[model samples]
Target: METQIAFAFDSAQVANRFLNALKSSGIDNLKAKLFRGSEKVIVSYCYEDKGFDQTAATLDDLASRYDGCEISIR
Candidate 1:
């Protein structure tokens, strides 16, 4: 299954850093490209049966790295 991930930051500064991280590192083997919204970064991830677990771990790491960033997965 494919999971939808949403990342919203408190400021553009934080958002930029998050974007840079996403660009610099590969988020596992996600097949989708990340696109930025006016205030958030959104991407779709498909990882068979481990979608939610990997998504959660990824979000947790990102949230810990960037204090002002908010993340949601579906």
Candidate 2:
């Protein structure tokens, strides 16, 4: 299974913070990219046997922790 999460923030600093939080979550199957101009971070994950709900929950938690951050999952 594969999941892609796009995070948009008010500033680059906030976006970097969110990216750090995602990396520290210890999800091994994830990849992240930062788009400075748009102040967004894109995270892509590939899991062998996991459901999307778990990923969504994790992302939701991260968003709650970071102010001015919005997430869209695809």
Candidate 3:
């Protein structure tokens, strides 16, 4: 399965930090990209069912850490 996440930030630095954090969270098969024009970061992951709950928990931690940014999942 695939999960996609997108969030916008007011500054590029913050966006980059968020992207890095996701990468370091130990979530498997994750990929991330940033769109400069929109100051948005998009992340996607494809993996088996085992890591889904952990991924969601990691995301929740990130949401708290980057409280100033806007995040959405699809």
Best by TM-score: 2
Q: Write the per-residue lDDT of candidate 2 for residues 1-74, one digit (tens) a residue.
A: 67777778778888888888888897777888785455788878775573444775677678667764545543
Using Cα atoms with residue i matched to residue i, what is each candidate's TM-score against the true structure? 0.61, 0.73, 0.68
Give per-residue lDDT, candidate 3, residue 14: 78
Q: What's the TM for model 2?
A: 0.73
- Minimum summed lDDT over a 10-residue window in model 2 is located at 65-74
What is the C-alpha lDDT profile of model 3 across 1-74, one tens digit per residue?
A: 88776777767787778888887887778788885444677767764576445665566568458753446543
Which has the higher lDDT value, candidate number 2 or candidate number 3? 2
Q: What is the descending TM-score order?
A: 2, 3, 1
Question: What's the true lDDT of residue 72 in model 2?
Answer: 52
The residue ranges of model 1 lying beyond 4 angstroms of the native Cα positions read 31-37, 50-52, 69-74
Whole-model lDDT, candidate 2? 0.72
Q: Count the backbone clashes (under 3 Å) in each candidate.
A: 0, 0, 0
Off by over 4 Å in 2: 36-38, 47-52, 68-74
